[model samples]
Target: MGIIDNLEAMRAKGQDSALMRYSLGNEYLKQEQTDQAIEHLAEATGQDPNYSAAWKLYGKALTQASRYAEAVEALNRGIEVAEAKGDAQAVKEMRVFLKRAQSALDASG
Candidate 1:
């Protein structure tokens, strides 16, 4: 079976967690399916509000979909969650994405 098939099986087994949703979201992002990625990533973040990785991916997916304002919001929240969790790497990475989103907004405006 494919990656998505496996993920679907896992989900059917009630193995739904933040990490599981994040993995599905990342896979969608890899395929450039931003809407699907956003849906899965939103689930992940909802499952675990402190899931910095999910938040990061969510922001990126939003940016890819040309939702600059939403991307900025997700990135800002991710940065805060990362900082509070002492995830230095996550914080740094999200900040870079946040700058990209901000730049996009500025360019459009």
Candidate 2:
């Protein structure tokens, strides 16, 4: 079965696992299916809004889809959440992504 099919089955089974959703999204991303990646990543983030990795991937997908503004917003939210949780590593990584998003926005403007 395809990855999406598996993910659908998992979701139907009430397995709203953030890591599973993130992995599904990563698979979609590997196939260059940005829309699918975005959808799964969004679900992952919704399941665990404090999931910095999901947020990072979501922001990357958004940026690749040329949703610069949304990418910046997602990255910023990730940074804030990480900081609030005192996740130093996540915060540091999110700061890098935030900088990239900010640069992209600046270049677009």
Candidate 3:
């Protein structure tokens, strides 16, 4: 199995490693598997709710999957996480992404 498959297997086995989930999500994203990416990234975010990067990636995957509403929600959560962590850069970046996702959702509706 490939690295992502191995990571997924580990996750299924209850590894619950946030870093591993994020890594697997990134690999899935690279392969254009937005659904799998979203799944793993969501798990990563759940494992560490304060992880702004994982939330951002999850938002991105949701957006790519054409789930704009969910993307906006995830981005908003990411922004909140970043703000709570006092990460100015992450907050700023997440705000940008959130706006973009909101726009996409608006356009779709």
Candidate 4:
């Protein structure tokens, strides 16, 4: 009856898509289930490599999980995708997230 239930039902019906996976990832992120979020988000990006939003969220979720190196990687790709897609807002936000990830990476070294 919740968003996850509905989304899972859709997936069970063979309705998989980048959007579906992105939504799942977003919901999992909201629940602070970074591992599940990462899984779905990775799938979302793989399903549609050009999905800037998914890439952004994926980067964010990675950062949240303290996977700084991977966060930096995902954020870099997300910025490139957003730039190509003319998503200036997403690009700006991703840049901020990138800086955070880079800082975390440096600190860990």
lDDT of each: 0.93, 0.87, 0.89, 0.97
Residue runs of model 1 more than 4 Å from their true location after superposition: none
Off by over 4 Å in 3: 12-14
lDDT of 2 by residue, 17-105 (tens): 89999998999898999999999899899999989889888988888888889999998888888888888898788778778878888
Instruction: Please give, for residues 12-89, the per-residue lDDT of candidate 3 as tens digits.
Output: 897878899899899999999888898889989999998999998899899889899999999999988888889899
Ranking by lDDT: 4, 1, 3, 2
Query: Measured by TM-score, how close is model 4 to the native structure?
Result: 0.98
| TM-score of each candidate structure, all chains considered together | 0.95, 0.84, 0.89, 0.98
Per-residue CA lDDT of model 1 for 1-109, tens digit only, reads: 8897799799999999899999999998898878999999999999999999999999999999989999999999999999999999999999999999999999998
Q: Kindly indicate the candidate among 2 and 4 with the higher lDDT.
A: 4
- Specify the highest-lDDT model's number: 4
Error of 2 at 1 (Å): 4.0
Pairwise TM-score winner, candidates 3 and 4: 4
List candidate 4 stretches off by more than 4 Å.
none
RMSD from true fold, candidate 4: 0.6
Which one wins by lDDT: 1 or 3?
1
lDDT score, candidate 2: 0.87
